[model samples]
Target: MTRYKMEEVLPLLEERVRRYTHNESTSVTYEKARQLMESLLYCLEEGENGNGMDIMAGEGDVKTAFTLGLARKKEKIKLAEELFEKIRKDFHSYHNHGYEETVMKGMPAFFLRYDIEFDGKNHLLTLDYPLFLEIEELTGIDLIYAYLKAARIEQDFLKHFPTLSVEEILRGFNGKYEEAYFNISEIVLYKALGCIMVKRPAGGLFMTEEDIMMLSKQLQERSKEELESKLQDALLSLDKELHLQSEVSEYFMTGLPKIVSNFLYYKKIKKVFLLFPKRKQKMKLQQKFQDGRVMEDEALRILIEKMQACESLEDRLYMVKENVRSLRDLKEILKECFWGDEFIQVFSLLSQEEVMVLKKEMKGRIAFGKGCIYKYLIKI
Candidate 1:
């Protein structure tokens, strides 16, 4: 941009405009021409940034600069294509629609129809799908190349595990995750860290609110550097257990801070209370934790019925916090709760005597679908 004056490039730009319009037009809107100029400079910037070259450092004009840039762009595209081949060889979509669309649809379009010559600045695709750590500062081919590089690393990391384990975790992470964009690697890493934080097996079991609380406490106790170090340790442990390649293990550090930040945000939102989330579905089941106490408050009774329809712990907790008023409400909710720990959250809400009273009151036989809860409660 600094090397050539608009006046100096005007005739060259007019020639390009004429060529693009098939010699039928010699003029365009100033903004369009400016964008075309950026297209020209985009190539030069690509050359300089990507290949460590200074195309405009000397007496090079826009054409020469653009020539060098186009060469770099083509090289990047070729490398991206190769990376795409690597990705396609053993990639699992995890049943995620966004990942499928971005890889199967968006990437192919970019490779097939990108106008590297006349429209290098044109960012043709809406990369609605995001990586664990997204590329935000770059656009067009720069974004594509960077994204491919990150995705290659993610593919390398994720493919180390059994595809079934991955599928299970992704489904467990969000049953509705596929409807929109999500970071596949982030979700997997989240599951891994959640287990690590609680001394459970990494990459198994859905993390509950209690696990989130423990994760937040562990992270919040540390200095910024310590938090980074802790997550790095967790990621490295997973890497060692999974036998990830050395460089791949190293690359995981970039995602730790983002995860830590996300966990801390949950604390700012005050994540108190628990709702035992055993599984997804509806079935005829007896209710315990009630001990023959009828819910006489009609509005409260209606709200409890509404609670039965909520599927996730987060949703149930929000509903309970916003609607349920007292310990009686919690006890009533517990009659429908399927399991406990959320590891010690339900108990944290009660005193020693109240807990003893509730423990004695919940002594009835288990509901048909509430075995996990019965097993968990008797242990208390």
Candidate 2:
């Protein structure tokens, strides 16, 4: 959560990387590296200050930081690939294993590791951690840790406003807000008992006045133990299954641009309650939706409905891969089973699996049109 100048952070990063090289127990975090990169990019591109005409840094400053962060990411990947190659060449024990191999073998103490496997014929590796070793060696930040840090950092931005009239702001001064119909995406991260709940501005649960009052009443009525238990059950669902995608599968499965938007537009909601900003520069928006709770509430309602309409796309992929008989059968099962948005994601992911499976199934032939469904499914 500490802020460091680039000069300080660079040496720190180098020292961290050096320490990681010597330390065997260290772990690499994909999200932390990403968050670090993002912070760099944000500083660089956004000029390291508020968007005020005088406060903003020069364009040169923006480009330098932005490009530096990108270059570092590229370099990290190159280093990771080199390290991976070295392991492949020198290590004899690590072979044809998936992500679970490290746990199973108890050897190959790599700073970063990948699961290499061949689905019968073609060799493949899980694309889980391409820069795992590099990030671990250079930075020991994990996604959750990064998120917590980010949440803290983001709350500072809210200092710009202690309170504002939601309706008056929506109307805007002299109708200027009408012209500035900008939307801002925000995230509120808070602990519910032992768990963390992530609520985005437009696409996650929101607390209504009634809901808030009800919660307060419940807190007053129930014993601390009872309240804590209920709150834990309700909010800790995000942490279930010991994986990031378990609780917020929809968030991750969202397209890259959307994911980037969420991260870039991230903000920590606090005591300051402001419905909409009359000025555009105050917020980073996910989409150019209307400027008010109406837009947020609608987005939340839609997201909830979408989330409820279908099973997790990851689960569905495995289900279809294991259960479906043919492309036609898969098509039929998914047609009636998935939401429109979920269907698109499921099809894209499943298509990759289908190609891998099809290669093994028919020796690369179009036997019985088993893989033909992929062509048709993608158009959806």
Candidate 3:
């Protein structure tokens, strides 16, 4: 969060690199060192201001900080040498206990440091300026080259398994499939089976003829329990997937009732009230009153009356203030009734005069020919 200027930091970076070069006995002197230092200084300054460098810095450990400072100067030769030594130590520890040892690779180390891909083309690696700018400050080499090398490895792997798709990546193998070395092909087939199982209803638990044929073909090389186990796994997965879909639909349904209530209240429109039946008797009651249609005003009046007659203190107060035309007049009346604290807490949004007028109006049923104010207020 602290702001730093590149102009201010660049001199500091140059001084530090010079000091490091003088203190450390290394034959890695070059003109590119200053450029690398500047690049790192730029990345750190930009990252600090833009909030992007923390990913590279991680938790600011001593090793990472040292690495970052060296990387800014583009001292790839030295950085690579250091990384190779660390990897060698790791491999040695594992091999000393009679474990099979594979040589500690330079490309993996480079990728872990810079998070870049390397293709076969060396030029492609060197030309990656963004990678250099972002990672050079924290690493010792040009990450662009390492990234290109990693990309080459990925490409080579993909070429061997040409039919791999994203769907195959999601279906992980259970214990049984582990023995077969379940590759991308089996993973894709399992995903297809899962999709088919999800399409079937709960009661229709039996596999379809097409699914059975496909399953039989896929499992022709495996045991019956493996196929059954996969089917069981698919069914369990479908249970959670289907429930999520249902919950999403239910969330949309909740909004519909609120929408219907608001439209009726604001637009002065009469509409049928949709009620959920709690029991079979309630369904019969709904059936008996299927033809009944309540006017909007009449329904509001009944609701208001029910609220007034209710024994609940909260319900009575909510009904009175929520329906009031003037909240100021209502507040004064609440004060007279020793309900000032509740009035201020609940109706802070309304003026005191408006609350007073609302209270006075509620006392009498003011008739105005066919259009009565009190009757309309009660209806509301």
Instruction: Say which candidate scores most in TM-score.
Output: 1
What ranking of all candidate models by lDDT puts the best one first? 1, 3, 2
Cα lDDT tens digits, model 2, 1-380, are 22335674564444343444455534447654444444443333333333332323333333444445344444444454454444434232111132224222321332234211101111122223121111221122122122222222222222211112221233322244334322211222221111122221211122333333344444445444564454444333533422333324333232223322322232222211232222111231212212212324454445435444655554454454444444434344544455433443344333344545433543434532353433434332
- Clashes found in each candidate (C-alpha, N, C closer than 3 A): 0, 0, 27
Estimate, for each residue in 1-380, the C-alpha lDDT of model 3 and write its tens digit: 22444564555556555555674643334544555454444344333432324644455533333345344434544455555555444332111111111123434444355421111112212332111112232332444334333323222222221121221121122222222222222232233333444353321122333544454445444344554454545535543543433432333233334333332342232211111000011011222223333335565556556654674444554454445333333333343332312332223223344334444655553322123333323221
Top candidate (lDDT): 1
- Residue-level lDDT of model 1, residues 224-315, one tens digit each, is 56766776777877876667777677667766677667655544554311111112211111123324344468877787778777755545
- The regions of model 1 sitting more than 4 angstroms off are 48-59, 200-226, 270-380
- Kindly provide the TM-score of model 1 when superposed on the true structure, using C-alpha atoms: 0.65
lDDT of 2: 0.33
For each candidate in the order shown, give its overall lDDT on alpha carbons. Answer: 0.63, 0.33, 0.35
Clashes of 2: 0
lDDT of 3 at 145: 35
> Which has the higher lDDT value, candidate number 1 or candidate number 3?
1
